[model samples]
Target: MTISIAHLGPPGTYAEQAAVFYANWLVKKTGIEGILCPYPSIAQSLQAVASGQTQLAVVPVENSIEGSVTMTMDTLWQLDSLRIQLALVMPIAHTLISCATSLDKIKTVYSHPQALAQCQQWLEMFLPTVQLIPTNSTTEPLQHLENDITVGAIASSRAAQLYNLPILANGINDYPENCTRFWVVSEGEVEANYRMSSISPSHTSLAFSTPANVPGALLKPLQVFAQLGINLSRIESRPTKRSLGEYLFFVDLETDRSSVQMKSALADLSIHTEILKIFGAYNVLPISKDLI
Candidate 1:
């Protein structure tokens, strides 16, 4: 059977590149040929998996320069059937694409909010007077060029090649260490080859909310991990959308979820938390320099 994989795209998106990279890895690891299905948005790509339109979906979770991608995080928390299968890191190199060849000819710049934020310094230093507009996806702006030389898009280099647009600037991201962490989620559990060893230490992602709006409500859950010596790699708080002052905490711990210390800590944490959802436990793959 062919595995249908979904990703955000129009073609030549960073998400599409990630999907392709993971597809190759998946085939090498399992001998299964994977087909890539591109969707309009990250949420829709993930929804395709939950709705059984596809077997797997790859979505961005966080960026090294821009913190977390809020939509990916919030949607993952809301979707119950989807679980992370593996984590892949991709080096991000934002480029300035337009019909014109010179940077000064560009009057307006467009890109996804996250991409704009990552290239904030470079834009400010060079195109200080240019109008910065946010689009839904990074490459979505490419379709709006309308033969206008003043319109520019901050997108992937591959996007420039695909759209036949000239890359006015390269490596435009302010930080040289720009990278994004992507999560591969699916409706069914992954096979043994994809599963990280429970015996070895691994990364675990979970979301939880406090029982009440009282003082120290958040501190108690964190204390459980601290007391257990469980190292938290990342923690983010998102508005729960239920009420004012209510929020959900998403945490990534360094130990395997099946470990004794993690289980005990989670059990103790349950007493203090109103709801807890363990998303998944998986291994992380670093993006190679050649892949960038």
Candidate 2:
């Protein structure tokens, strides 16, 4: 059967690249034919899977430079049916795609906020006076490049190639080791058919809200993991939106959800949390720079 994978696009966004890698992996591992469905935004791409419009969605969860992707985190918490099936870490190299003859000719720059922020230092040094506009996706501004010499967009090298746009500058991001972590998410339980023997599940992600805002309320659930010797790889908090100080905590454990320690920790954690969601345990695959 064919699987429909959704991603943020006008075609050449990083999310699409990650989805393409995952789709190719699916073909080689399970012989499943995968078709990509591009959405205008990350939230819509994820919503497509939650609404059953697509079988899976590939959305970015974190970036080495910018930290957590708040939109993805907030949407995942709000959507009850979606769960992460796998994670892909891909190296990012932002290129300046434009029709301008040189950097001095560009007046306005456009790209997704993350891309813009990733290259913030570079932009400040080079195009200090340029008007920076945020678009829904990196490739959203590509179409305007050919018609306007003064317009430039920050995007992937693959994007420049795909759109046949000229690269005014390469490696424009602030850092050399820039990368993004993308989640291959799907509705309901993660199918065993998609799991590969070569890949080992290593991380478990979950989110929760405390029963009360009282002192030590959030500390209770954390102590459970600490007592079990569970190492938290990452922890982030987002506004619960219900009240001023109320917040939701998202954590990534180094152990799988089915592990004995994790099971014990969860049992103890339930007592301290008002809501707990297991976003699922999944293996992480790193996409080599050459692959991109």
lDDT value for model 2: 0.92
lDDT, candidate 2, 1-292, per-residue tens: 8999999998899999999998888998899988999998889998999999999999999999999999999999989778888889999999999999999999999999999999999999999999999999999989878999999999999999999999999999999999999999999896766554465579999999999889899889989999999999999999999888899999999988899999999999999999999998898889998888
lDDT of 2 at 263: 90
Error of 2 at 112 (Å): 0.7
lDDT of each: 0.87, 0.92
How high is each candidate's TM-score?
A: 0.94, 0.97
Model 2 spans with C-alpha error above 4 angstroms? 197-200
